[model samples]
Target: MGFGFVATQILAVSLPILLGWALNKLGIIGGDLDNRLSTLVLNVALPCSILASIDGAEALPDAGTLVLLMLATGVTYVIAIAVALVMAFLLRDTEDARVSYRFAIAFGNCGFIGLPVVGAILGAEAVLYAAIALIPANVILFAVGPLFFIDATADAGRPADRLRGVLASLKTPTLAASVAVLVLALAGVNRLGVAGQALGIVGQMATPLALLITGSSMAHYRPLEMLGNPRAYVAAAGRLLIVPLASLIAVNLFPLSPFLRAVIVLDGAMPVATLGALYCLKSGRDTKPMMQVTFLSVVFSVVTIPLVSLVL
Candidate 1:
């Protein structure tokens, strides 16, 4: 069952790439479309997706399970960060390459890819647990993730700089949605009525639109060139295999429920976040290697996720 769901989700992620490739070939959409789609996904679709999934959660885990899942999520990221730093030093020659590689390894597409896969395999309750993971993931991605690109010229004099960065990161639409949904759920706002229905409609667009945008961006790259990067392969291995294996060990050492354990393990096995490369671009670092790692990790996770699922 886990394998079947994973196979279907992989196909779902890939189909948009094919569509984007075809559209690009026909001169229908360009880079501008990619940006527009990303904005929509981040600001609208993703938040709705979070709200839709969490608000309608039928089975909430116990407080212990939630605490355990959070711990596993934090530890998985710490290990990933350590692995990324070591891999960056050993594998990459240039500072930019090292920064990009480290960022790719440290983050995963836990929201867009993860929520759907977990929901499919472990059901809606598990998605709620996965969202708990996303809260910290977003914080780390926005705040500490950029520090990878900090060069000698970076200004660390002001404490306000770090605070401002964190504040800006927390203001994202998805985070807003996550918090809103949590509030609504706590307040017993079960029947969102028109708002819920509307969010559900928009939220459904997050995954396909995200996949399409990712595919469209990929259309510009030469597959042979991207695949030839050794760093990409190492990062993919770390993201798909090593991180999840570490997560499995951490979860097992605790007495967490099977469902909680499964959620953490599967999340650990997710591909690098598509936005990591974009973040690298924003930080004036190399995006090529980051993109390479993200694309290849997704390709490899088609196998790794299923195997990890079976093991769990």
Candidate 2:
């Protein structure tokens, strides 16, 4: 069953990626089409999914599940940050590399990859669990990840400007969606049946659109750029393997719900997020490493994620 679930997830994700590649190669989808698809996924599809998931799962969560999630996530993040800091300090000697290291360590493509994969393995219930996991992950990605990059680049420019950059990023649809979901969830509005149903319909679009954007973007993937980069290899190991592996080992000592344990490990195993580039672009850091990290991490996650799932 685990193998079958993993196979389904790989197919679901890979199909859209192939479609995106085909579309882009055919010139039927390029330029503004990519941007529009991204906007649709980031702004509309994602927020709707969050609201819908919360609405669907709104009964006060099971105590065991909630505790399991908190422990798994908390342990994973703590270990990831520690390992990332050590890795960054080791790999980084230059200003740009240091900042890029921070982004590589902290951000994982949880939404675009994690949710769908988890949903495939564990079902929509697991997606809801994954969504809860993303709450903190996205916050760190948007709020903290860029700040590290900006600060790293501070020697080249004034440090204070990074504040404005962070503020500006607050307007992005993904961050805005995070806020919206949290607001609606806390207010108990998503629990209302009519509102919940509407949210579900919109939310359903997130996974498919996200996969398509991934596929399209990946269609243009540059293997030469990523294949031999030592930094890229390190980042991939950190995000797709080491960080998750460390978390899994720690999780073994705890008495958490099996589902939540599985979800957390799965989330940790996701590839480096594409948003790392957005952070680099916005913060005046080098984007090359971020791209490398993202590409390699995604490339290898096909093997890494299933391995994590199996052990869990």
Candidate 3:
């Protein structure tokens, strides 16, 4: 795909966010509607979207490539976590902002944004590799991802309490869907049937709804403030530029194919996952830093992603 295609896809993705913000500013959409949309996204749309992506066993790479992709993904997250840790140390502000920085640094918008970008720019085959990359990424995203937001510092006496919280959080529909996709694929179940088609249709709502919710969340804050603070900009720099550039250099040390390498780097280049804002909404945390960082990173990614792609 050309840079025009890249710009168009990003515009398509961004318009809803703008609309959501506009509607909220005009008082057309209210909190009740935002709550319902958030619930629909987290509980229903996101899970369906995930399952619908892997419609059959054929959607995955071959077993050998699958192992290689899994390993590459593992290494990718390892690098991501390392980067996030460094960021966490650097951006030591409020616990909330720190968590936002750490979470956004560690995960990118792979499933929601990267899949379509890769499919359009690379090819169908590369899209499949991208899909499989999400197996490990989502597992981490939904599994341990929330822990970043949770306060393990509260009580020194109860590690068990924290463990239980982590376990309970894992029961979310998104994580369940991830496990289901893996099991179904490994079992060689190759047909989603009419139900699958229905799921695929509903699953399409995930990204737009996520963007809208994020925008609505942002609307709660002042428009000028939503542009973000200096620390938030630092996080944006890491999300949009620093993290992906590191991945592009780091992944070359691995034995991955060129396509997988490109996918890994491009995945890293995606803007902050809207999932961060979703989690903030769910837990009633201040979505300030996340929303700010997400907004800046995504808008900058229009140029940043294309530049990174040129290198690839």
lDDT by residue for model 3 (183-297), tens: 6666666588998789889977777777777667667766588674888888878887788888877878877777788888887788898789878876667888888888788
lDDT of 3: 0.75
Worst 10 residues of 3 by lDDT: 119-128
What TM-score does model 3 achieve against the real structure? 0.79
Clashes found in each candidate (C-alpha, N, C closer than 3 A): 0, 3, 0
C-alpha lDDT (0 to 100) for residue 254 of candidate 1: 73
Candidate 1 Cα errors over 4 Å, as ranges: 153-157, 185-190
Which runs of model 2 end up more than 4 angstroms from their true locations?
A: 55-68, 92-94, 151-191, 252-255
- Which pairs clash (backbone N, Cα, C closer than 3 Å) in model 3? none
Candidates ranked, most accurate by TM-score first: 1, 2, 3
Q: Taking the tens digit of each residue's C-alpha lDDT, what string does model 2 give over 1-312?
A: 478777677766777767877888888886788889878877777767766666656454554655566666766777887888888888864777666766676567887767767776777767666766676666556666755664632463555675676567656565555555555545554464887788778878778777777767776667797676787688678888788888888877778767777888888788877777876787666777777778878778777877877778
Better of 1 and 2 by TM-score: 1
Cα lDDT of model 1 by residue, 87-141, tens digit:
7888856788787788777778887677766765666566666777777677777
* Deviation of model 1 at 309, angstroms: 2.5
Cα displacement (Å) at residue 110, model 3: 4.0
Worst 10 residues of 2 by lDDT: 150-159
Each candidate's root-mean-square deviation in Å? 2.5, 3.3, 3.6
The CA-based lDDT of model 1 is what? Answer: 0.75
